[model samples]
Target: MDRLEAMAMLVSSVEEGSLSAAARKLNIPVATLTRNVNDLEALVGTRLLIRTTRKLALTDVGAEYVATAKRILEEVDELERRAAGEFTTPRGELVVASPVQVARLRVLPVVNQFLALYPEIRIRLVQSDRIIDLVDVHADVAIRVGRLRDSSLVATRVGALRVVTVASPTLLDKYGWPETPEDLRELPCVVFDSPSLSPWRYRSQDTGQIYTIADVPRLLVSSPDAAVDAAIDGIGVTFILEHDVHEAVIAGKLKYILQDFEIEPIPVHVVYLSRAAMPAKLRRFIDYAVPKLRELLAEFGRIPSA
Candidate 1:
């Protein structure tokens, strides 16, 4: 038996709680898993598992061996990868996740360009609004917008999005721009559905204080994209990320309002689990992406940190 392969199979079997599951994960037959494990037990001269019809439980010796096996396998993998010049030559599949619109606007272009430079790297992008547990989802990296929750992952702040209040040129011309937060209550308003946002909690640069807008929604939308569209059609003034309407703002269809009174911009980040020796694929991607993201979003974003 290949002792290293047996050790790996035994570790997988114990963790998975079944030989069948381990076999499925490793893409090997259950018989092969059984044969290797039996061989491993014969070599060690002890029973490693207490197996029944439905479940497999680890023996005392098996538990200790599994722990040691995992550490040994990790070291072996690192040694082999390094020996093959993997640290210098990036070649592997990268799994990444991001919210839908952000993925399309922020991440997709960067990934597309990256594929051109490294033909060996394949990308699998998972788009969802729900925050995924990187370890559970088996994702290698993620693009995070807004404030992040507590996590052990390494977060590199890329830039700050200009989440400013905006209105159509026609509405501004017809009604004129409001001078104070209180003025918004009397004007047509667009309300977006989000938990983190509060109509009252905004930094007012004009007064150098947090200002509360007592405005009620003249129109409510589920998505920020919809709010921007409503504002462009002369519906009402709405708070939106500047990047979403970068082209329209330049085309004079929409106008940014209360620049001096705009609240603090939200942060954007790229987050991943740290490793002792980082893989070339992940390291190179981060190096290639950070500056490009800063540059691409320069028109509608601010780099809060160097």
Candidate 2:
């Protein structure tokens, strides 16, 4: 028996969930595939799989062996791809996760352009606000905002971002506008439930100071989008990421206040699990995404070369 080929067959069988499925993928007969697995178990002097009519289960030893086999196969596949001059050709499923707004405004366009350039690469763009379990979701990469809680994942700095206080023109016309952060207390405020908890932040031009404004909100909502809607409807002032309110501000739907009191830029990142070697598809996407994101955020200004 060819042990390497048999290992590949076993791995494929486990992944495909049935011997017949593996057989179909490998284009080999079911009997031939079963024989190869049996021969492999015999050669290894142990039963690797427990076969049932409905399902195939890996034994404890089989489970451990399968992990080792997968690593070996990946390395072998990389070697083969490199030898064939196909290692750098990006072609595979690439799953990425990001906050809903970021994915829609920033990452989706890049994803579209990337797919156009690499037709063979399939992408799953997971738009979410809560932190996603990369392993559970099988996410290959993630675009993260603010500080990352998980230190285990490898993170690359994208750029810094800031929050802005904005209100709709209709709202501004109804309620008197605040010239400074302290003046916000007189007007109704819209609170957004986010990781930031809607803490109003500002930087002082005269004293060169930055501080968080502690004002109770008249209206509160679970999402930034909702808060913006309320603000646009002449409800209250809301604090949100500058990017989130960019369109509304540009289209004259919303207007910003206390621009002089804007907060210092917060870091943003692209994080992924630590890998023995990054897949070509992932590496290429990172290379393509980082600079583009930075460029888009550059209007927010760079972090002064620290």
Clashes of each: 0, 2
lDDT of 2 by residue, 165-244 (tens): 88877767776778888888888989987775447778787887877778778888877789888988888989888887
The most accurate candidate by lDDT is: 2
Judged by lDDT against the true structure, how good is candidate 1? 0.80
**Superposed Cα RMSD, model 1:** 7.3
Kindly list the per-residue Cα lDDT of model 1 for residues 1-306, writing each as its tens digit.
999999999988987889999999999999999999999999999999999999899889988887788879877977887888777789877888987677889889999999999999999999876677785455778988778885788999988777767788789888988776566776798877654344645676546687676666888887778888899999998876767767778777787776666677778889998777888988999999888887776655432210
Model 2, which residues run further than 4 Å from truth?
A: 1-89, 204-210, 299-306
Which portions of model 1 miss their true places by more than 4 Å? 1-88, 195-200, 205-207, 211-216, 301-306
Q: Score each candidate by Cα lDDT.
A: 0.80, 0.82
Prediction 2 global C-alpha lDDT: 0.82
Per-candidate Cα RMSD to the true structure, in Å, reads 7.3, 7.4
- TM-score of model 2 (CA atoms): 0.66
